[model samples]
Target: MNIGIDIEEIKRFQKLLKDKNFIELVFSRDEIEYCSSKKKNAVQHFAVRFAGKEAVWKAINKSKKLVITDISFKNSVLGKPEVYIKGKKASYIDISFSHNKTTVVAVAVSSK
Candidate 1:
């Protein structure tokens, strides 16, 4: 298994989402919905999704054809974040995310 993580300021993410194109570049409907259900603010959820996308990309590196939207998170019955790939059959993906007053962080793991 390979693991990767990324952390960035909330303000930076807010700026990026201001560009509609950038938002389109990084999020999926499921991810947006799940995150939105967890957090009241859309922008905060977007930041977490952005971090998850970066972490997934970093973990998969050059070996997979996954795009940003190809990675998504949904809530399990336990309300935990579950990560999955859209169109590829891979080993596994695990994601963790957190946010503070100023920053958001995400970590991902993938195995073959």
Candidate 2:
């Protein structure tokens, strides 16, 4: 089992979203919706997604081919966002995102 967690302030996310590629590199539709529902800024949501991707990469041993789209959120019965790694064996991933007026943070954990 491996775990990787990341957190960032909202202002940092605001600046990073200026890069179009960065936005496209992360964020699944469900994640965007989840962030939007939490009243987080679009850029902040994107940032969380980016952080989630990086955390997942780190947890999965940094596979170069693990693009953002390769990981997705499938809602559990409890409505939590369950992480899925495409075309792989059963694994576990946990992701969470939170934001205040000035900061946003994301955390991810994985199990082999």
lDDT of each: 0.76, 0.65
Tens digit of per-residue lDDT, candidate 2, span 1-112? 6777767676777776677675555665666666557563676666666666666777775644676677766556886656777734234677776666776666777766
Whole-model lDDT, model 2: 0.65
Query: In angstroms, how far off is 42's CA in candidate 1?
Result: 2.6
Best by TM-score: 1
The parts of candidate 1 lying over 4 Å away from their true place are: 36-40, 87-91
Please identify model 2 stretches exceeding 4 Å from their true place: 29-40, 62-65, 74-77, 87-91
TM, every model: 0.80, 0.66
Cα deviation of 89 in candidate 2 (Å)? 9.8
Tell me model 1's lDDT, rounded to 2 decimals.
0.76
Task: Give Cα distance to truth, residue 68, candidate 2, Å.
Answer: 4.1
